[model samples]
Target chain A: MNKIFFFLGKGGVGKTTLSASLAYYLREKNKTVYWASIDPAHNIYDLLSLPASPKVQKIEAGLWVEEIDVDRYLRRFLEHIQEKAQKVYQYLQILNLDKMFKVIKYTPAMEEYACLYALKEVFKKHEDKDYLIIDTPPTGLMLRIFSLPFVTELWLKELRHWREEILKRRQIVAHIKHVDFGPGAQLEFSKDKVFNELNAQQKDMQYLKDVFTNPKKTFLILVINPDKLSLLEGKRIVETLNKFGIPIKIVLLNKTGHSMELKELNFFNDLPQKKIPLFEGPFPKQVLLKIASLWVEDAYL
Target chain B: MVLKQIKDFLSQFGQGFKEASIDQIQRELEEMENAFALLICGSLSGMPAPPAFLSLCLLPYMERELKIMFSKTIFLDDKLAVWSDLVEL
Candidate 1:
């Protein structure tokens, strides 16, 4: 079984419900489950009938639930950068980091970075779990989150190269002038503080990249409604995921009805497909458990 | 005595050449630093930059370069020079 499962779909397509049900299902099988909602429009807590603000809470003997507090997580991410910066910058105390951060929080793509950082942290923290279920954001943002590591890795490579070139030049000049070029010049490029920090970030990104692309370790389950719009979005998501080398293990047709003709759509032909019946009432834990019982045994098999 | 003079002149020439090369390299490095700062923190100047969270992550290591970039005078008349630097990069 894949160690990690990501539930992805359009908004209001029952991704949270299906993912929560899967977590509950896994718990019944005596598997350790860590279920997290990484979507900005978080609904996992609401679906599970728990308080919304809990970062991580015990659901049962082996299942844990978390609704990521994005604001707090973003602040923690900034704090992480600040701590690393203090170690790297000799005069970090002089910089008005708070003021700078106030400006930075409004910049484009900051939310995406924060989301990715939080996801990475959550994934790292629960590596020992038998199953890690992620309820991702809506299609567009979730795709961006998945693609972030690739873009980040590319930029980091270029940045590392540029940094090394600059350092090499500095060392050469120091040698010619017979001057001590400071501690940075004395150390190998990998040991240089700036290089080391970039390297650390690269390592984190690479770990995620590997996990995301490896099918045996990670399974992407696309949750879709039987409606046309959801199917369209799911198609695009599947294509993008394929382009990024993330294997889509299953296409979940949620809120499915007797119009079995929707199953014949060409988009669903490529992957394993499962249909979920339309439920009439609120999806409480009991309802989810009943729904889960249908597929828990053979869902991944 | 003549040989000694030649030797002294050669040493001075070598020192001057080294100084000039260092100066040119420093200028090139400075230009690269400015471009890099703009790549990350261009939002500060109303130019589109990479994600602020990432820029913030890199800002600590780039404090010195950014300071130089911010302090350097911007000249409207230096369009050609700016073009050349961008082309070189």
Candidate 2:
């Protein structure tokens, strides 16, 4: 994709509406756009007053929208793991995988894993699109999603190292036995099933880390209302991205007309900022189409 | 019969002219395999397990180690009882 724009903010910060406006603008500019909401509390359909679709839907020419069912993605992710387990370890079927998955379903970071899975799918499938816009989940989950790749990479790397060492020792045993001791002894480090699995996971995590940390290909648009809490959360988002070396391209000061003190937002003074007028009710398509000029051109075009 | 027997002896020797059983190496190899299994799937025995997602796939490849673990656990539970049963009913 030419560019990936992630609209990130706390809940009720108009992430859905703002991202929709950017998607509309990009399509208006004749760029092929794929807009998706990875948030569980998706409001993209409501804001546009369009029917909710679990799959990607074409909206006129050069535009597609999807509201991802993250839970479905989670289930699919587990199925993928089970399928791999079957192929890599044939006897895996003896274990009641369904029961194990039921436990994994509630495991910490599974939601984040699901979101990462969905994100990779979108990137791979829609690479031909000129611009991809993702309306991210609220702050906590979205941050975790962005950082999941980096954290997972660290873990899988250590696992791979230990697996190689195990294989090395196994080879020593096979030498003395003059027989391949079960399956483990027969494996070279490169040829082992477990080592290969770990290698694949490491590669995927590194790819995601590259995508998130690359500033030119990916843009982080922080959406915050002109209020104390939103500004504080926005600052934290910026700081976290900085820690990851991922640049925040612009801060969209949403709901500007409200009398929330701007003094709190001095944190954003160093970065690019754009103001969008506070509207009274549901965002009309006409208004979204018009507001595109306010920040889309300045921030993206 | 003498010629056939000589041929058979030669074939057996040729098949593993380099093969030899070494007890020390055998024991060390067994130890490595057991440790590998214990580290990866330790959670099955109420030990601190690796993240299930990461280790779940390797269950089949570690089948030998797992069996060893179970046998060892059983033996540890009542070694004397197991030996007494050797007398037969």
Model number with the top TM-score = 1
For candidate 1, report its TM-score. Answer: 0.86
Q: What is the DockQ of each candidate?
A: 0.36, 0.24
lDDT tens digits by residue: candidate 2, A182-298: 644455877777778778778888888889988879999999998888999999999988888889998899888868467878889999998998765577767888777788764
Candidate 2 residue pairs that clash:
none
Q: Write the per-residue lDDT of candidate 1 for residues A8-80, one digit (tens) a residue.
A: 9899988888888888888778889999988877877677666776558887899888888767877777777
Tell me, by DockQ, which candidate is best: 1
For model 2, the TM-score of its B chain against the native B chain is 0.51
CAPRI-wise, candidate 1 is: acceptable
Off by over 4 Å in 2: A83-95, A260-263, A298-301, B1-52, B57-65, B68-89
Report fnat, model 1: 0.42
